[model samples]
Structures are given as C-alpha cells and as structure tokens.
Target: MLESVLKTIYVIWYRELIRFFREKSQWAGMIMQPTLYLTFVGTGIASAMTFRQAPGGTPVDYMTFIYPGIIGMSVLFTSMFSGISIIWDREFGFLKEILVAPVPRWAISVGKALGIGTIVSFQGTILLILSPFAGLSLTLWTALKVLPICALVGFAIGLLGISIAGRMESMQGFQLISNFLTMPMFFLSGAMFPLHSAPQWLQVLMVIDPLTYGVDALRNAIYAGIPEAQAILQHSIAYDLSIVGLFSIVTAATGVTAFNRQG
Candidate 1:
C-alpha cells in the first residue's frame, strides 16, 4: 500500500512537470514579472529613497533590501497560480480519470503541491542569479541556504492554491479568487517595504500574512553574513521557519481534506 501511494505521487508529479516544460510560455510568464519588478520598479524606488536594513546600522541600497522581497513575490505568484492546473485538469476530464484511480486522494493533493512547489522554487532560484545586479552580495553559501527556504515557501503557498482550487469549479472563479488573495498577500507581506516602520494596523495585517514570514525568512538567509543581519531581520531564522512550516502543515491538511471531499 505504501509503495502504491509513493508511485501514485511520483506519477502525478512527473505529469505536472512534463506539462509545465511543454508549455514554453509558462517559463517566460513566470520569470517575466519578477524580472520586470526587480529592474524597473526596484530601480525607480532606489532612485527616490535610500534604505538601510536597520536604523543607523548600515546604509543598504534599496535594491538590496528589496531583492529577497522580489524572490518571495515570484514564489508566491508562481505557486498560487499553479493551482489553476487543477481547474484545467477538471475542465478537460483528466482530473476525473485520476480520481477514479485506485490511489489515496491525499497523495494526489500532495503530489500536485510538490510538483508545482518545485516549479516555484526554480523560478525563485532564477531570481537569485540577478542578486548581484540588485546590489546584493551573493555567495554560493547564501544561494544554497536560500534554496530550501524558497522550496518551503513554495510548498506552503502551493498547498494553499491547491486547497482553494479543490473547491473551485471553474478556471474563471479560481483566477478571480487567487488574484484577490495574491495581491493582498504580496503587498502586506513586507515584500515591497519594511514592516518595522509600517502603521500599526498594517503591521497587524502583515503579522497575519503567511508570506510575511516567508519573505522575512528569505531576507534573513540571504543577508545572514552581513553585520547588520540581526538588526535587519524581523525574526530569527528559527521563528520564521517555524511559522512557514506550521502554515505548510495546516495547508497540507486543508488541501487533503478538500481533495478527499471532491466528487
């Protein structure tokens, strides 16, 4: 039984990967938004204001400060949108075929999440290649540490998308609901700005956003070697990971439950 479950997951994961690679447009679309934001938006903001990771610690460039945020933004968008694949499967009757297979429903959900999460992590890594251009001092060690965090962020958000897609009947509805959730999550996640100086009400919202912890964690990992690391980090790496892990667990359970209930 265990072997069967593992095989089922691998099959689903492989299928998703194949589908993603076959659609070359997915590559362009996934990478374009983050690239544009990092270059144009990041440049514009950097010109207007100087940013420091911490008050009087070190004068960090605006581009450096926002680099991790751009990575988080990429992972969040890619992972969340990847859930629409479920709707597409359903529309084409592929999902029905999978449902009828003699495999655990939870495995299906997990497999889909993992498949898309891998894609999201890949997208995030692509952004890491641009770190130097963003004024960040990238090291091999830093990139390695950042990779796992990206995978965790991707898995958590991918599960969220899966949970929502499981309950959605149409691609239109899924896209609408996803856009509504993604925009707010990105803006409030401290992705574009520092949360330390945010208004009280905004801080509360940021605290509740799972992506906030993800971004903070990425920032902590990416800047771990900097002298101002402690001052710049919103929370310790352990705390940030704990929050993201908890979120992943909750969303995994939720996604499995949704898949189990699907008819």
Candidate 2:
C-alpha cells in the first residue's frame, strides 16, 4: 500500500516538475513578484520604518528582521493559489484528461499538489539563494531543517487551490474565492506586520489564519541569531510542520474526494 502510494506520488511529482519548467511564463511569474517585492517594495518601505526587536528580544534592522516574513509571503502567495492553471485546463479540456486518468483519485490530487508545491518552493529557494545580499543568513543545518516545513505548507496551499478550482464552475467564482479567502488570509497573517502589535480581535483572527503560523514559524527558521537554547526554535519547528502537514492532508483529501465524486 505504502509503496503504491510512493510510486504514485513520484510519478505525479515528476510530471508536475517537468510541466513547471516547460512553461516560460510560469517560471517567470513565480519568481517575478518575490524579486520585485524583496528588492523594491519591501526595501523601499523598510527605508522608512524604524528597526525594532522581534517577538524575541533580539535587536536587528527592520529589513533583516522582516525578510523571512516576506519569504513566507512569497511562498504562501505563490504556492496556494497556483491551481489557477486548473482554470485554463478547464477551458481547454486538459483538466478532463487528468480527471479521466486511471490512477486512484487521491493520487491524481496528490500529484497536482506536489507538482505545484515543489514548483512554488523553488521560487522560495531562489529567494533564499539571494537572501544574504538582502541581509538574511542561517546555518547549514538550520536552512535544511526548515525546508520540509515550507514544502508542507506549499503542498497544502496547492491542494486547497486545486480543490477550489475543481469545485468552482466559473472564473468569477474563483475570483470571489481569491478575494474573500486568499487576500484576507494574507492580510491577517504576520507577513507584513506583527500580530502582537495589532488589536485583540486581529490577534484572535490571526490564530485561525494558517499563514500567520506559517510566517511566524518560517521567520523563526530563516532569519538567524536565534538563541541556541531557545524554545522558539522548537515551537516554530513543531507548529510549522504540524500545521502544514495537517493542512496538506485535509486539503488533499478534500480535493480528491470532491473531484472523484464528480466522476
């Protein structure tokens, strides 16, 4: 059972990877916003905001302190709604081919999730590659350690996107989904601001927003100078992995069930 699942996942993952690179616009689109956001919007804004201590007591410049949140931002935005391609597939009939595949239903959804997740993670990796010049740094062990967490979140986002795309009947509906769910989720997350600094209700809202957990956990990982003995590292590691993993399973299962039900 496990082996079949693994093989199915592998096939889907490889196919997704190939399709991801073959499209020029997709690659360009994935990296474009992160590059511009980090280089222009983020830096441009940070030039005005004063540096302050993070949730931890560590003192640092604003850009450095906030860069991981931006990385999480890039990943969350790029990865989650990536199922927009399903919209095109719906129009042109490619989605039918996928839907009619002989493979198990979950395998199909899992494949799509992994494909989009991996593709989006690459964009985050590119940001990581350029991070040092942008004033971020971390140990080899720490960097490698944080990746699975990020990938899990990416996978969940992609799966949820697919589930939404599979369920919706129109682009207008998807646009409403984007506006109602995606944008609000991003705003509520600490991607651009600290949750503690917000009013009590906003803080309460942030708890339900998975992106907030994602950003806080990633911020703990990618940005350096963590105290060696601190539980923040442990808590961050635990929450990020747990939340992403939960999201992936739930969304993947939901997407698979919803699509296969239509069959």
Candidate 3:
C-alpha cells in the first residue's frame, strides 16, 4: 500500500512537470516580470536612494534589502497560483481520470504541490543566479543554503495555492479569487518593502501572512554574512524555518481535505 501511494505521487508529480516543461511559454512568462523588476525597479531605486536601515535596525543598501524581497515576490506569485493547473485539468476532464484512480486525495494533492514547488524553485534559482549583478555574493555556501530555503518557500506557497484550487470548479472564479488573495499576501509579506515601513494596520496584516516569515527567512539566510543583517535580526533562523514549515504542513493538509471533499 505504501508503495502504491508513492507511485501515485510520483506519477502525478511527473505529469505536472512534463506539462510545465513542454510549454516553452511557461518559462518565458515566468521569467519576464522578475527580470523587469530586478532590472528597472532595482536600478531605479539604487540611483535615487541613499542607504536606509531595515526594520531589523541594520543599515542595508536599498538594492540588498529589496533583492531578497523580490525573490520572495517571484516565488510567492509563481508558487501561490501554480495550482491553477488543477482547475485547468478539471476543465479538460483530465482531473476526473486522476480522481478515479485508486489513490488517496492527500497523496495527489502533495504530489501536485511538490511539482509546482519544483518549478517555482527553478524560477527563484534563476533570480538567485542573477543576484551577483544586484551585489550579492555567489558562493557555494550561499547556493547550498539558498536552494533549500527557496524550495521551502516554493512548496509552502504552492500548498497554499492547492488548498484553494483543489475544490474550485471554475477557472474564472479561481483567477478572480487568486488575484484578490495574491496581492495582499505579497504586499503584506514585506516583499516590496519592510514590514516596519507599513502602517499599524498593515503591520498587523503582515504578522498574519505566512509569506512574511518566508521572506524574512530568505533575507536572513541570504544576508547572514552582512554585519547589519546580524544586528537587525532579533529572531533566530529557527523561528523563520519553523513558521514556513508549519505553514506548509497546515496548507498541505487543508488542500488534501478540500480535494477529498470536492467529490
């Protein structure tokens, strides 16, 4: 039984991956916005801005502060809506075939999340490669540390997407709802700006956003060597990791439940 479950997951994961890579347009569309933001926004801000202190109390370059946030933004937007494919599959009648298979709904949900996570991780990794241009170091240690963190961020957001998309019937409805959710989630996450820069109401919202912790974790890991980053991060790496892990698990379980009930 365990073997069968694993097989089901593998199959679902493989199918999603094949669908993604087969479409060259997916890669193009995914890369375009991040490229524009990194090029235009990063450069534009760097030109006009003097250095400022992050909410963590450390003085950081505007580019450095926003780099990780942009990474978080890229991962957040891509991963959170990755499960729109679930709705697509349903519309095309492919999902019915999967639903009828002798596998647990949870396994299928997890598999789909993992596939989307992997794809979005690739997107984040591409941005990471470009980070040096934005003034970050590209060491082996940084790469090793960042890869896992990116994967976690991707998986957590992908699970969040699945939790919504699993039971959704209409592609139009999914897009409408996802657009509504994504902007607030990204903005509140401190992706474009620091949480401390926000008003009190927005700060409270940031505290509730799981992506806030994910962005915080990425920033902490990426900037570990910087003296100011060390000074500002009152919370340890463990705090950020725990929050993202907890969010992923909760969202994944919720997705499974929703999928099971969708029948």
Estimate every model's Cα lDDT from 0 to 1. 0.88, 0.71, 0.81
Which candidate wins on TM-score? 1
Write down the TM-score of every candidate: 0.96, 0.87, 0.93
Candidate 3 per-residue C-alpha lDDT over 195-229 given as tens digits, one digit per residue, 9 for 90 to 100: 66678988898898988888888877788787775
lDDT of 2: 0.71
RMSD of each: 1.4, 2.8, 1.8
- Cα misplacement distance, residue 46 of candidate 1 (Å): 0.8
Candidate 1 residues 1-263, lDDT tens each? 99999999998889989999899999999888999999999999888776654556667777877889999999999999999999898889898999999998999988888898778777877888888898777888888888888888888889889999989998899999999999999999988988887889999999999999999999998888777545667898899999999999999988876678767
Clashing pairs in 3: none
Model 2 per-residue lDDT at 20: 79
Which regions of candidate 1 are displaced past 4 Å? none
Identify the runs in model 3 with alpha carbons over 4 angstroms from their true place.
55-59, 232-234
Q: Write one digit per residue (lDDT tens) for candidate 2, span 1-263.
A: 77776787788779778877898997787778778877786788778866452546555555664567677777777676677777777788977786676566677778778887777667767777777756656677656745765677788887888788878778878768866777878888777777656799998998788877777677767654645213223245576668767767787777776476554
The Cα error of candidate 2 at residue 258, in Å, is: 2.9
Worst 10 residues of 3 by lDDT: 228-237
